[model samples]
Target: MTSPQSVYRAVAREVNRASISAPATRSKTIVKNFRTIIESGGQSNTEHFDHDLANAVTFMKSQRMYKILLERYNPLHDMSAEEKVKATARRVGLDVPLRENSDEGQ
Candidate 1:
């Protein structure tokens, strides 16, 4: 035979306890979400850095190849006018016919 006032006090105590813990629970969840976002941002930055590095490496290699070709072949000095035209077209992936290929028509 608990008094009605005693029952009301018991329910009020439990409600107060829940209200006190709610913010702590919400704070923990927010902290966890923030940490996850920071971690994912770091990973995305790493991936972007890796992609940039690979592109830089590819560009460096292409520059090195162009330098080597300039040194080894000296196209302006070594190639004739027609050869230069054909070589330029071939480098640009054009299918314009050269003298040899055009000669097939004669």
Candidate 2:
């Protein structure tokens, strides 16, 4: 039977290892704490969790989601507003040669 303190430290150590890439480490920590709550094995819906901590965890999840979206996904996902305008200009017969790699292609 593992002690609560041991479990706590193990979670911190493991989550810290993953934190660098995830940036959602704090939310993961909250999840670990919540597991600790259930592991205490009290029978009840009587457990009242802290709202502020939950909110913090929720916000961190959102930030991590968006960070992943914009940083890892946005570049090739769609045109930027300026790029869209440039495309429109090209469609209207302006000199917007859209291929940035035209010179390299030769």
Candidate 3:
């Protein structure tokens, strides 16, 4: 039973965060669409609200995935291949087993 205001605030926060790296047009579009839904009273309709929420969730997921991929593949970082893999694994909630000869524990 989440309140509409709470949901709006939460989505707004995520939209702002995603917009930081998003292209200007794309960010504006997201904001515009969200505002349209809100202003149209879509939240009062369960189906409309669920559909728009799903779209927002999908957009956020893609934004996060893009950021993760960018970080993983960015050559500017000094991360080693194994370190990159370990980082990705950690992000996905899995642990990379330590090698016996690895110096990471030292």
Candidate 4:
């Protein structure tokens, strides 16, 4: 049985090898999250954390790692703005129309 740490390492190795977009993006995000978690409880300043993350993201954006990951990710595939709005509405149950079939507006 593999531990999560081992799994993460393996994933990271694959992420490093993958020039595809998605996995690289995911790896970067995971690394950022780890950084945040690491510094959250310490004397770490918010600005420092933000600045570091921003810098790291920028650097990551330029690497072969980033390009490979981005290709896998292919930023073009995310939900459209319209779809996102509709999804949010559906989640809150706003999707069901309140009007009755016999309403006067009909």
Best TM-score among the predictions, by candidate number: 3
Preferred candidate (lDDT higher): 1 or 4? 4
**Cα lDDT tens digits for candidate 3, 1-106:** 4455665666777787766475554546766666676666653777767666767767886887888788787743668888888878988999998669667668
Model 1 lDDT, residue 77, Cα: 61
For candidate 2, the TM-score is 0.30
Ranking by lDDT: 3, 2, 4, 1
Q: What is the C-alpha RMSD of each candidate to the true structure, in Å?
A: 26.7, 10.6, 11.8, 14.9
Off by over 4 Å in 3: 21-33, 74-106
Q: In model 3, where is the ten-residue run with the lowest total lDDT?
A: 18-27
Least accurate 10 contiguous residues by lDDT in model 1? 2-11
Q: Candidate 1 — which residues are off by over 4 angstroms?
A: 1-44, 75-106
- Cα distance off (Å), candidate 1, residue 32: 37
lDDT of 2 at 84: 75
| C-alpha lDDT score of every prediction, in listed order | 0.53, 0.56, 0.70, 0.54
Local accuracy of candidate 2 as per-residue lDDT tens digits, 1-106: 4344554455455445436656643566555675676466433432342333344445656666776788685553478887877867877899765567767878
Off by over 4 Å in 4: 1-43, 65-106
Candidate 2, which ten residues in sequence have the lowest lDDT sum? 44-53
Q: What TM-score, over all chains together, does every model reach?
A: 0.29, 0.30, 0.44, 0.28
